[model samples]
Target: MKAGLSLVACVLVAGGLGAAQDYSVVLPTVDVEGISEQDFTKGYVAPSNVEVNKNGLSIKETPQSIEAVDVQKNRNYGTNDLSSILEGNSGVDASYDTRGDGIKIRGFSVDGGDIYRDGVRDSGQIRRSTANIERVEILKGPASILYGRSQGGGVINLVSKKANFSPLYKLSARAGSWDRYGGMVDVNHVISDTFAVRLTGDYEQGKSWRDGVKYRNKMISPSFVVTNQDGTVSFEAQYTYDDAWRVPDRNPEKSVYDAMGISYNKGFAHNGDFVKDTLHFLRTELNAELVHDINLKWIAGYRKASQDFDNFFAGTYDVNTRMLTQNYAAQQTDNTTLSSTVLLNREFEGERVGHKVSFGYDYSIEKREPRLKYQRGFTASIDPFASSSSWNSARYDRVSTHNKHKAITHGVFIDDLITFDERYHLLIGGRYDWYEFKSTDINQNSRSYKDGAFSPRIGVLYDITPEHTLYASYSKSFAPYGGNGWVGVSTTTNDIQNLAKKQTNEQYEVGLKSEWANKRFMSTVAVYEIRHKNNRYNPDSNDPYLWAQRDEKSRGIELNLLGELAKGVYMRSSVGYMSAKTSGDEVYGYRNGLELENTTHWQGNVFLRYAYNDLWYLEGGVTAYSKRYHYVYNDAAKSAKGAHLPGFVRVDMSAGYKFSKHASMTLAVNNLFDKEYWRSSSRPGDRRSFMSTFVYEF
Candidate 1:
């Protein structure tokens, strides 16, 4: 915060000339301190304005719902990961075990493929870090037309930090409960008027409260930018290496769990088992304004990743003999991808109206080996009360997978923003996609699968007032038989034989939005219905095969309030009530609705931060959920009807003080009550913990 102000002060003192002549800048500086917090978002006040133009309109002018949180606000609250950043924004529920995306938005789960970084797909089994993130932008509704192959549930984009003209450096360290310790470094430098570079790195190691569960992460990202009078070009390369001993949580039979009368904190993982993940990412981008009110933007990227997982857990147990049946599985994957996107935007006058139109094309190719090497996993003979020495051994080989897959995708789309009478805005877009999936084995046997579809989106916005807007939209999405990623299918024909064709998704949404307090506060109410296909586990069938529900649907109402509440107080809060159900031969749960398992019926969070003068600040928040169903063998068995995982409320708080212009310290407590609860029927929540951080800037 001080570094930014110092730059502004220098610009004002020098009368807009702060650097060399060739790379000099100009600005009319008057009152940097007098600037209203509502005009921009930093700290707590959410920004009503956004820079990304995928919607082709200003935030308030766009028909879709969007929300963003800057880096400073995330730092002040001690958020360390993507899921942590989404906790209280717009009724989103997020959780991460330092692995995949545990985020749920509007009754839909966001997997690795559903998440994006800087308008590109960054999904995989790798963990996402906030160390190099500038802010998180969430665009709600179906994004298949803008981004390739997505669910009707929206997208989460992590914007990375970039090089700037100003030079700055920051260093920070943290220590916390469960033997957690880590540090981070951020540095930016300008080489010349037209060239700049930035570097960010972080390292962390922690031991969990649960026995034999530990993890480590090391990440580094370097970015460069070239400044041009008409436009700019930027490049970034990031790498992350992570390893952990994780225990995949599985809820025990309700009656069996009750009979043991033991805590759920204990895990079934052995100390020798481990999971390792590595990722390398590279991107180059250009933004240039063309002649005659036209603009062109291009981006090219490459990503390579590998994951090795060894899982072992107790599937069934015999209490009489204390025999634990250890189920084990091993998975290895290596993936490489190359992608590019080109966009052209133009503005012109129509006969009776004005128009802003966008045309873009996206292309990508992916090669993946879901099974890199076949590993022999064994079932171990063990007892809960016995020593670890009794466990069996697991072995792995280096041979490549028999069936490695390759995928190619092509999509082209055009969108237009038409304004009539300068009050009503209409947005219409459509896209066409061609996808091909091929598989090859060591024996030279090969097969290919191809699919194609069209997606469309239409929305209209009316400016009821200058600060208030009403909008409604309809959108459609398409997901190929096995999804977009190459890892989903193999040469084995029967793997996806049941799904001979693609699946479709659709959504309808209506929303109202208003802002006040110099654009410092914004409130929205949205009602939406989402329909899609689902694959669920059903034990009722004689063979116990996975059940398919072709017409699964989710309907919900969401309300959110963000921005400043008073002079020095700010809050971000949201709550929602949703019902997600399946219409099929299999009907389970209460009211014959058989709501989707683990779907959050009601969930919300409230985050507040208050500043006391220039040196002291405090932050706190609460997250809660309503009851949700756990897995049951018989849904219509008549006797087992209202079974659900208990709901919980968790609290988090933090306090920080700026000792000087260049230094600060903060202390935080998470899971304040040490609550006993489960999320998505996965596992018990983390226990209460404390952490303190010290930071220095130069």
Candidate 2:
């Protein structure tokens, strides 16, 4: 695990080795002029067209380190939601969990890979919120050979928002600073030339900079499409619903020297200010595609996702008695997910040796249930309306377990892309998966486990001209573990039967992709090495725990830049050098173990944009973090190393105007100067926030 590779060859020789600049600095100049007279030219489209080319479902073609977040660049940089539009790029990072929207790519988290939409499978597996996105694709490394069981860190595809034949309409609204608010409406209708209809809706509310945080959310998505006439056959249906509410743990723990609060403890300020929970989710998707131009093709899909969660917080905190509390804890949850997919696309040698073949099948099912409650003599000084059912109910804790988890997966895949005379090319793929798990508790007693796996991938492309391309690839992956949620509770600690082994990964890559001068801009450079095996740490089995097996390794180097470095200035940047270890672990028993926590060595992002004539636009950006270590102890007073968490820089600015072409307005400033950070290892990251937005178009 230590492929910092001389720190990525010292940041590409300080951004000067193998030179890759098309332009950087020297900006200003508006006017798109028919957007450069488009005739198909904009970052690799055609992964089945629908504006394709975002990296064409990546996996190889320069094999790893892919990033994309361009849906009109997330609306000219207002970049609302989805964690600041995926903030920095490269290997990505955007922390804040414990129910505050999570994202941690590369260093794992975000439920370890494979979250898709548009390529199916996007139930968001719990703790959710993504407002029916329309862009965001990241495939860094070890993609379980393209979505099988996941987690060698790499994969995130949320591209939903389609249905635009022509006629369109849009409406947007946002207001910020604490009492936040939101609005959105996007509709596209072309009920003719083959039919189409797309609708999107959104709503939001806020108040959580710190004191008794608050939140509210709503989302609705609708879609239907029908097209057939030379363009293959297409039929689609979609429905999404989301509702959210929060106010848990209600941060508010100021106590550095204490005097600033003369009133002593303000610890449990929730009761009247915040302390709530609610969540609901529903989804349905159905798709079908049959393209018959004789090149052979077929695709099918179906999905159903459901979720419900209700929780009540505040368990106990007195700090100094500046408050009163009793009756703590509550939870109720239910989840369901089902998925299916089938695909086939073919063309085998004939037409000057440009062979292509693809076949795929997938299935997923999940179910979960959780219910826990304990409340006794609740009393935060009663008064302001009591009666949480007069409190008192606490007993269930013989481990108070409840389980209902079921998972099944079946997969078959084959891919081959060969083009020998076009300038040497070859792509290969293989997949086979059969996994199953079933459990039923709460006395209903039942258990089951099954497994089968295989995955492989390979790629090579060298066109070197006609627009540069040099690539390399190798991939393999398999990760399965009853499907998440394993924090041991029965069967003598760290249970789940030895963590159900089935985790393996391998990835090696090299890259270069280019477009010079005429293509308007594009660049990429990648290097990667990834490894993981066994990785099932189970012990503490019902207490004194004692079960172990582990493995890990992650390596990196990536740099990416995107288009239009001229003409009203447009830019995007990425810099990354990652390190993750634990290769061959055995801690306490002496083995490979060291590294993991905050996971970073270097991370970066830079964005610059400007516009003046469509009535003005402006943008600025910078993001950085470096410094790792937060846990893994060998007794430094109970084990702690490199307790460093200081290395952060943020700057953001925004401006927008266009009071005509159908109205517009925008204003933003985030952390502009009020820098204060702590992306949640327990909350604190919201210093300078401000936003204003409005728009309408037809």
Candidate 3:
């Protein structure tokens, strides 16, 4: 990690010097007129163009619900992690769990394959860093037509900062409560008229308010691009190295603690509980204008990662005795993935109609190997309130199992947009995927399966007026018998039998997109329903190996508002109401009609920024969610009245001062009122904290 940091620093210094030497000779200025000033500086405003849809479509043109997060602007409020960024978005729920950041969109968990970088799948298991991320785009509802198999809820695409023909050099440093401090550097240099290079790096270390928790992260991304003077053809390459280490915190169940008359503030993690992850990523892309007004693009990416996980967690508690059962587990895993995409797009105009068409082919292969060790027994019981030292006495057995899993997927898709005059637009697309999964155990036993599915999408929009559009759409998605990436499919006979059934999802949606204040502000209101069939689940608690299939559904309404609300005031806000429940029969009849776990009925967020003057600004935001259940079967007898995680509201504020055009500073306070709440399974949200950041630009 140290060597990587030093290398990035050296490159930045050398590049900065070279840029300074050529700064005056090659730099040029041009006059501009009639451009809205808010378009350049409004942080809360949404971008007009989005890349998640493959086809070049403006946000207002897409029939489905979508949202984007401006990472640069969010930094003012100390929002750095992906989980925090999504938690404030509409119809999305995010939290930290034992396995790292866990996210759910519209009440469905986002599979590992659903997260993307520059429109390519990223299968790494580590918590992602935002140092090189410029913005995040989310497409809500089934996206299998373009992205292949995934959860029906949505997909998140992180757009990385790339080299451009713009000269820029920036340095930023931040510090906050909980011993948190970090520094970042972004440097972009135009080597010549046809080439440019960019480097971004950051190092962060912090101690958490939770016991026995500390974290450190190091990340560096360097990229370069080559293009013609006319920009008709271009090629780019980028590489990233990221290393992260942190103590894992597995807090005691809040409801269990209350029933046992114990405090839930403390975690069950021992001092030695820790997780370390390292990732290496490489990508290359090519784009060109073809004959007959067609465009061609090809992108390829590769990722390798290593993870070390060691933790001690609580299983159950005896209410009368105040005793807790502890278990020790450890594992090391390696993951690798290679993926590529080739796409062609063209548009033509006819006498009374216009058409735009896009087609693409995608291929990917992923592999994982994990070795496990664990110790679980009655002797591991301990006092609920015991100190961390008391839990250190537990021992882990030798390696129990070594397993390898691999998945290969191929997909072909095409989409077309038809326009009638200038008032009506229609979109139609379809995708066919072939997926294969294989698993092998140390005992020389292997199991494999193959599956295929076809997904279709259709939508139509009518121009209610020049500023408002009304639209409706339907889409479908599917997941193979075996899951993707590290969450490999089970090879057991019973499990395979239950999962063999085709697992599929279908969604219906309607929405209205409206532009206000001359396109300076925008709002979207959408209503959607998604039904999941043949959902796999564990049937018997005592027999963890047993599996079954069932059906589930989620219906919701969402509203998102972004951009300048007034003269000097900018606002971003969202509100969503969803009902996610099991719809079909289950092995345990009582489980039917139950609400999905880790989902809330109501969620909303509002953030506002007021530029009092050219030198000073004030910002504040509020995020709130209703009560959520940790388990699907949260009955009165199974869980105590106060066992569920209660709903809570949190407030955050920031103040910024611009000393000059070259430098600025921001002071932010998160969780302003010090609200204590549980965010996920046995995990508590951060307490009130303060952060200050300073930035310099050249």
Candidate 4:
């Protein structure tokens, strides 16, 4: 693949070099803050400038559906973690399962392996701390060209806080219902004109609505930077360590309404719950201006993490006896990840055209070891209303080594954006990746497999005006099979045999982006169709082993509106509708066009904030979703029709007051109406939790 790319590069460069060089202009860059602070972040909207794309084209010139949010601003609007941050964006639904954070984009669930930090892939089940985050970007549609081997749903890019050459200090404390309490410290010091350092830390402890569920967590991040006065060269190092002990939340159960025609034990806690996790990561980077029109940058990162869990909320239910039978399970993991990347960016000018070119290579190595154990007799059964729901792990003698695996991936990608007189933009990019996986079973024997893919993307953007643009794009994406689906880890042969090929998907999208009132308002609407292959499922073949199939499809429309709505008023809202279904051959006698499980056909949200005075403000939001199916339909078998989750609407409200120039207080109420809504099949959302925060900055 490397040799083939080199040949292709030679031809592209040779062909373009023949053109006469007769112009000079400033180089385009991917600096999210380059556009003036007010334009980049004001009101409730963030800038169109993004660093996720290799080319620094604004969102209007990217020819794709995209969303971004300013963490600080969203914090006032009840945003937390990647999922909540995306609530104001179209076609995104965030949820939490026994795992950690999960998200659905355009009818596709993005696996943990597809999440990214900065420009590198992450291999840990992260809960996502906001202490070190500045902003996040959701790059919609096919993004493999920039992200390497990944799902077709797109990638979530987090931009961490950077050290600034100035003095900054902030302190904040928060307390809320369910005994929630936390505090944060953020400090930045300019030791010298050429060197600066920043440290951010947070600590929290809380009890949940569920009985016996409690959590304690702490995180500390320190970043340092060194640069010459000329700003032509710089070096940075960032480090973080997080520790947490949490009582796992109870899982959702079959609502009594389904069986007894009434809600019973609907929000009951059903777990012996415990989970402990720790993570450490270090990232180093270097940036240099190599020539008058060329630059270089590189990043090296390492991460180590572990999780220990015992007693979760998984059990079997006996409807007739109105009883629950339970089991005690314990699990743990030890993992290490190493990655590095080097990128070169250059700019050239022609009489009426220009180019922004980028080339990069990245490699990653990951290793994991896991242990599992179970005690079947610990908690044999619990009466539906039993008061004693305890399990005894001391009775279990031996822990088993279930599985351990490692993976290595190498990728090389190149991107180029050709600007024609600054009106029409043509972008092209592609990447080649080679991935290998090896896993070991309890018997100490291991198996290995290898696969690769070539992802390509191209788009065109036309500017009707500086604030209005129209564009279209088509991209290719693929994900290697045998991925554990948890942090891009390795999968064992017992889980997926052969694993010879990868699932592939292609996307075609067209959209319009517009802005008004000097960047104070922005709106975007996009229509897209995605055709996916290798979405395997056995067609109810009663055989001991079944082969995978490859046909699934989805189409959708997304709309996002943000920025100022009226005088001293700001609003952010989004809506999405999609039809995702199985195609071609029937599965388990289901119709070829049955809707996929857990996918909603309609989802939308709106949040608005109004500034009453320099010292007072108010914000409120509403989130809604249409019915979602929980199972696949047996279309040919009328007796096995699928069931759907009823649609729901939720509301939240907040108010704030600035008592002084350096101090402010805010109060927020979630589930303002105390609506009893389920986030998934069995997990009900928190009901009317109140939070109060006080912040001081200098």
Candidate 5:
């Protein structure tokens, strides 16, 4: 790790301009002070404001429900990336994808949401690394009006760390439970007053212990930055690569069905004699900005990302009389995306009001190839004990399915923040988007449509006093749909799926932002009502094998508090209450009527931190989840009415000691009570774990 840091520093310095330029450059910066106190107790700081838009706006000033997790707090809580960090927030949840490549947020049908790096869509995919991240921002409520298309719930922004510019070097390493181990290195150099460079990397592996969870990961990134002072024009470029190996589900299909109380016959297969997953991803981005002496400025950026995944699941199920041999199985997907955006900003109304206009386009191409082979149940003497059992009738190999599709999105937007006086301000924004989708598998169903939508945002900031501000906002969101699959007999038809199920969301919010006691403490109290409409779901489809559709609604309220106490102690906490239900009257596929399944009522977290002198610090926190229900098998059966995963509470703690300004050691423990609780209503929870680390920075 030390060698790597040294190498990066040498290279960056070597690239420095021979002589200092009259102008300075614009690059990334970290604001370590704005992070939560609990994080400060963990021996790390983000080193920048870490706010939305990367404009250094304060959380209290941003007209949205925004929260940032500092690098320090991340270490204290044992977080790896967006998923782990968000688990502590009140209104967030995580789920695994079928391919086990990334995590899904909330109860949204998808695995990931729009991602931002320095306020730009860094990458749209959910799979990402935490090493390059300096801090994370969670924006609650409908954001599609501000960003492009997005869910009604919220968005997570990953603030990437920029060049130190101040000349610094750091290295770290660690080995822990499950044979997990890895190292990281970071360095920056100010080639001249105008040029700088930075580099970071990570390598980790572990023999996971979960029944079917074992894997390893490798990630590397290198970046460069050049800027001209007057803070005008700047350029940044980065390349990243990541790879991982995963093993999924070792148990047979029946066990899963039994656990979830889902019906399964002998004809359907769900187990894999052996499963392995390999993934490769490459991403590149370029960003530039031009700021003129006038209040006018221009910002533009472009990004490209590509990934491939391979999966194989094979097993047999027990059918009726004849011992049947059923084979269920194979999938592969290749995804690629390219996007570009440009925006103009300027001040008006004698600098009392301002406006920013942005326009961009995105194109994505996806391919899915699936093949399934099945046969009647069978009982053969052909050694079922073999790793590759005999019942495995790999008949699907002969039939191949090829599917390719492309999606295009174009959008234009303008925002205005108007101030009536130094004490009052108002903000409004509108956006228009057009979408097109085409697929090779769709016959007449495959169609193209154009729709224009204007979502408005209204906000007000009232300065009650120098130390207090009252704010309120209303926002809306609409998300388009992609093509769905269907079963065709002889030839495929272009029955392009209709846009009947477009997702809609809106939020009404009010909050008080305050700084008190000589600015030593800060706090915020916010209340919100969020609603979703035109939701699509498979209703009454209890037959585990059936796919259907229905509509549901989720609404909730949330509260949060953060800041420092006396004597270097800091505290942060939040709580949420939500109720979600399907409308009683709805019709889609099979069943009808309304029920409760996609709603959670309560969630919250409390984090605290304290520093006892320069060498030592202490941190602790707890995240709580409320009870959730799942449809049970045999609703008439005495013990099979409704499956309930009782609410659970987990605690985490960390302690760190600094040897000097440049070195530190820390230890952290998660699930401290060893309480066994389910992380998902459908899966068992993991056991308690521990992690420790040491680092040196120059």
Candidate 6:
């Protein structure tokens, strides 16, 4: 089947190259801050302007490292999810598992409390879909001045597709390996001279190469916009549902398995071991602009989400008996969030100095209810080399517990961009936040805490010429204990600790931004060091569940380039190097100078797209990563020899042909060489795969 598909793709590409013609493709206008309408079909270069900072600054003027991924163009490369798109970026490590999507920026984890949609905080417990996403913007370094109580690593903001004045209709179908199939629809209509409505939706269902793994995802979003002389008002609502069932696959130690005369690909997971997860999400947003001169803006958003997962995973392998134990756990959580922001912007003109000032007040309240159930020995032991028919034969011993948590946050921030002599610029910003957290356990034990923090940022930039700029910046951020959904605070239990203090992060950075080929291309190089304090970690290896406070530090350098390399040829590439290690006194089991787990020392990605005429195009890319330790405490004596996952490089290629003015098709081959690598210490990465997609516009 794979050979047949490859042949078909090659034939299509060969035929398309000879019959290709000059075709100018235009897409629907995207309604986003700092981005203007343009022909995206020509190149993958994204706009320089970004709204991630909330202060309205271009990439070169922000004195920070920033990157944007154009999801529309990435679709042709078989990039369908947030993790897949982020994995190819500089200084970002992203992966997806049964727990949902996880990301680390600059060697720091940003899995929760640092993700947003349209500038509003969104839930990070579930896998995010790209069906309704227009583009993803990443801001590197501390961002607490504009966003309160977030990870110091950085922020990921998803720009949602919104209703616009232009009329558009599109339909698409896709099929890939492992019986994967899906469809999508996008429609926009003008209801009146000043009103427009848009709807977009997609449905996907597929099985995985792994045994007994299946998933289904569906989403629908409807939006309406009203335009007038004074300003524009818009409303948007979205609904998303996801369901999945899969058997956990944990790769065993090759040395031990091979020594036992067992096959490397032998499966240890029983049929009963499974993961079942479901999520339901609903969101509504209202944005209005009152005055055009000062650019007064108001945004109100509401989100309600519920997620449930039930799973049993294989644990501890008894080397003597070659038997694997099963662990069962289940959780159900519901979340509700209400957020609002009001901002005012104005510019003061002066002969020698000019100032652009922006100030905003934002408030948010979130309530979460989570219930959990678990059992240590849920089922009987299973043989590593034999299949088992026992499934759910045992019941959970621990009863479910209902817990409630609520958080209320209010922040006020102001930023001023001062331009001096039309060549030098200075940026100053500060934010103050008041946070309150309340929690109630199943036994009616209640606790409340209040905290306040002040975060500040400063930067300076000097334009050397029309195409080059140099900048330096310093920033700080903070996050309260148990702020994100993953952690919980309890007054009656001894498990919760360090309730009086908050985690803090500080960073120092310097960078240069340059434009080439008459502003058709851009490159940025940045070097930064970040210090994190009050980090939670397990101090005792014997009791791995115990949590204690520690400190960590990371220093990294990154280089990123994007835009057209030549006429009809475009390229995007990046490389990053980081040294992440623990700091301060050595704890009981952890030693100072130990590298952080799951962080690689070197990573890089390079992609190039060549337009073989206007109607046909070909793209190829490579992503590589260095070896990473799976355990935080990498004691050579305790760890298995050659236990660390080795470095790997994967290559991918895609070809697209415009068959007609209204139709097109794309074929993508991932892992072209069928490389065998481990995604994590226990999980194997996907083998070579192929996907084909067809789209029509009306």
TM-score of each: 0.86, 0.31, 0.90, 0.87, 0.78, 0.88
What lDDT, from 0 to 1, does candidate 1 have? Answer: 0.65
Write one digit per residue (lDDT tens) for candidate 3, span 1-698.
37435534553443344333321211111001011211224457677767787776678878899998777666555666678777757788876765556778888877466888888777656677676777788999989999888878888888877776767788999999888999998888989988999999999898878767788989999988876555555678889988888887765566666666755556667767888888888988766655445666678899887888887764578777778776677888888888888788888899989888989888888898888775335236777687877765555758866889898999999998899988999999899999888988768678887889999999999999999999999999987763322435676565566667666889999999999999889999999999988877665433444667778899999999998888988889999999998867555556777787778888889989898466887888999988876563444444322245788899988888888878888898989999988787577788898989898888
For model 3, the stretches where C-alpha displacement exceeds 4 angstroms are 1-42, 259-265, 319-322, 375-379, 482-487, 495-497, 539-544, 632-642
Instruction: Report residue 386 deviation for candidate 1 (angstroms).
Output: 3.2
Residue 526 of model 2, lDDT score: 81
Query: Model 2, 1-698: lDDT tens per residue?
Result: 14334433443343342123231210000011112111112222212112111212332344455676654344333334565567556666665544434565666555423566555545433445566655566776765544677666776766666554656677888887878878888887888876778888888877755545567778787766654442233445666676666555333222221322422112233343332323332333222222221121122334443333333333334456434343433445455555555454555466677766666666666555655443344334322122334433332233244666666677877777788888888888878888776766678777677878888889888888868778888888777752233311233334566666677877887888776578666777887777777766532322223456677777788777766677767667788887777666554334355665556667787877676356766778888777544543453344444444556778878777777778777787877897765553434456787778787877
- Steric collisions counted per model: 1, 15, 0, 2, 36, 0
Q: Tell me how candidate 2 scores on lDDT.
A: 0.56
Model 2 worst lDDT window (10 residues): 25-34
lDDT of 2 at 471: 85
lDDT of 5: 0.52
- Pick out the ten consecutive residues of candidate 5 with the lowest summed lDDT: 482-491
Winner on lDDT (4 vs 6):
6
Model 4 root-mean-square deviation: 5.7
In model 4, the worst 10-residue window by lDDT is: 21-30
Of candidate 6, the 10-residue stretch with the lowest lDDT total is 19-28
Root-mean-square deviation of every model: 7.3, 23.0, 6.9, 5.7, 7.8, 10.5
TM-score winner among the candidates?
3
lDDT of 1 by residue, 46-116 (tens): 54455344534566766777777665455443456677667645536664443465776665666646677
Can you list the residue pairs that collide in candidate 1? 588-594
- Candidate 1 runs further than 4 Å off: 1-43, 48-56, 70-81, 88-99, 230-259, 349-352, 372-378, 387-402, 441-445, 482-487, 493-498, 533-549, 585-592, 634-643
